[model samples]
Target: MSFGPPPSLYTQSSVAADQRRRKRRRTVLLCAVAAVVAPALAVGAWLWWPGTASDDAKPTAAPAQHRLDVRETVERRPASTQGVMAVRLSTDDLPPGEAHEMPGLWATDKILAKGINRTLVGVAIGTDAGLGEEAWKLRLGGPICGKTRHVTVENRTAVLFRDSADKESLCNHVAFVDLDDGKLVWQAEFPVSGYVDKPDAGSQWDPGVTLTHATVTVTWGDGTDAYDMDRGKLRWRVTSREDCISQGAGGGRALAVRFRCYDADDPQSRSTFEIRALDPRTGRSRWTYTPAVGVKDVRIISTTPTVLATSAGDVGITEIISLDARGKYRTTIPLQGGAYVAECTDEITYLATEECPSLAVGAGQVFLTSKEQGDLIHNANWIIGFDLKTGHSVKKFESGPNTLLRPLRMSGDRLLALRESSDRISPMALVSLNPRTGAETPYFYFSLPQEGELFSTTEFADTVVQNGRLFFGAKEAQGPADADSKAWVWLAFGIESAAAKKP
Candidate 1:
């Protein structure tokens, strides 16, 4: 086809190449415009959206001016022959008791730390003549076969204890007393049945509390109830057969409850869970939701009028369920490996796993521990972070393997991780980890002596943080074979305000 107009094959080929080039250029230009316009459109839509509290909520103000000031470390040693069980702090200065003998038991002198210009309160039990009787007799409530189940402070006026003396009693009883005068305020017995074997039914044992506008929502064995603290009147009660009851308070009148219902026969039956919301004043149900099943040990990690239920399923599956204000299911997220869900905030949820503890939200980040897993013989434990909004892991920090991770405490931006190790002979260390960056700082580390063979026992009275100061108390063993080895010491540490900074 070398005809005159054959237009050299080369020329034709060149023309086709030119057309291809133009098409590509046009495509590039269009792509460039789309890229530049799409983001702009999104920004415009976001800015134009009506301003709602959920959208325009102001950023949390920086933690008020505060410091982690080490205020005091009191070493309280009981008398020579006495063993202390529970120690409590009161407003007045009380005399220490001397060891004495009673009808069938030995008693020691009672010791009370008083006259501290703080709302600090502590309680301890002792074994000896004078002290033991005084300590045990204080009886906020209980000969509770097990340790006291719950202790709550009420406006510095009274301390409430929920304890059980006999297995026949289904409901846990409550006792209130003046913190300053040690005067009994009021006591009431609640009956719980259905879950446990006992005469009293419907009363809760391990009751959780959330106060809203003078109303306290108590979650316990059989259901959720609201009480008016000021009037000391029962407002209303809702019955459900869930095992563990947890409550979260937010805003002024909103409250959320995490109800756990498990199958007695099938461990996997533990998956049944529900998060309910109600009006704190009227006790009217606002919303209810059944999150996905397949997990047991479901707990209320945290909430904001919203409920976040985290469950540890069979094998190594962990799931997080978010319920909206209407108690409707918002989303379900499956965590890699299995995780022990701790606390959840508006921003993130903290998780701990067996192999590696890390945070997730967008990208998974691992937290580094001061000690290595290999060094601890694969005992190193990690505290992982997960972003609440994105459903991805964010960071992981090392919380030593021997350490028992307590609940996550939020102070401003800093997330507090409390861990205790009972492996050591004396006292255990209370470590504080930065949840955001996975950096850990030791808060208090001490130990008490054991009665025989030094079987590494450490007891933490309470971990409370107020006004930027962390108050941790530990019971140190007096000495080997000494029943009096259970004296307590309260350590107050002023954490660097920076420790509270969010990651």
Candidate 2:
């Protein structure tokens, strides 16, 4: 999905806020130095050095500053994948149309959507039936015009869509629509910044939206709020505690949020890391965990209901630190070959690049990606499985050499990995690996529209496994412009991979 900033947004106020914050920070730093440094020096002189030295010997050369000790690549033992079948899904050769609109030159256009969502159809081979509606029509067109910017499938029969009413016009509302009749079930106007006017680069404070159990929990730049599914009423609202800042936060299917809290003054220091679980409805803390010693801070890699996966370390050296449901430490997987977890967030903060998440949480295991020696040259990535209950290393699976692999969503109990095709004429492929047995099924292709050179670099985002089907959105270009505009594509990788027609 297009997780980057919109083409144009009114960011002058945001920029002014930053300037004010910088002034406050400089004032605070100067006060902190004056309050502590002079007292500390007097104490040191009185106790340690009672008399001043007449002449000091030549000072030894100062020690070199510490730099991030990150290795470019690490080698790994190859693992075998046998007894798996390669499968590809049919897209019906449907292409997307323009989803973003531009009104004028001075005014920014509000009709921008990240991507569309469509269901995966897995029919039997040679028994193809036509789709009820054009896939893009199912997600983008029809009742909604160019003003609609965000649309998410709430359930089989309903969807959540946000239009220009809120961010662009100050009447922003996130409305739920019944898919069968296209009627608004309810709509909510969040308290903070309206429907995403722009995407943040990456910051501790940003917006994250998730819907579960007919409840919508939104964490925006200022605070977190939860709304009832029906009638769109506020259930709970919360702001961060003093001296602490709200970092990245997200929720799973269960509607529970593992919100991150960091010390505002020193986000990179030893005491900055903190994590806690919140009951979305109540806006109350359920459990909390703070790592001790040697770890500077904690970043969420991924999480399941029972397991929270994260990477902990100082600088680039990191170890996988998993915690159980109660927020107790489960196990610490030490730095394996000096590698850290690479992560990316669906709700990217403003001005931030994608994150490097170290691991992903799966059904019965936590999945970790490790770089082979060839990863530096090509996309040779591997997956390592750890038992969920015990947090123990279980198995390793490889997607062969000279190919890059990315962990997508889990289908049933198997972990789905996207295999980036190396051949110029070939499209990307998909593989499924049973986390328990380390058995990988190979080579499933999506009949996506071929965009020539852009197809190879096209990245998929907002991947969700819903109603036994996989739905994800992709954008050829991140944002829309009057000069050059592109539409969004929604690909549904059907569960049934029979002999389907190629694109």
Number of the top-ranking candidate, with TM-score as the measure: 2
Count of clashes in candidate 1 = 67
User: Scored by CA lDDT, what does every candidate get?
Assistant: 0.35, 0.39
How far residue 337's Cα lies from its native spot in candidate 1, in Å, is 2.8
Q: What local lDDT does model 2 show for residue 333? A: 71
**For model 1, what is the alpha-carbon lDDT of residue 386?**
53
Candidate 2 residue-pair clash tally: 20
Q: Each candidate's root-mean-square deviation in Å?
A: 27.2, 22.7
TM-score of predicted structure 1: 0.50
- lDDT by residue (86-184, candidate 1, tens digit) is 222211011123211000011012223111111222222211111222332344343221111112233222222334443333335433333333445
lDDT of 1: 0.35
Q: Tell me how candidate 2 scores on lDDT.
A: 0.39
Per-model TM against the reference: 0.50, 0.55
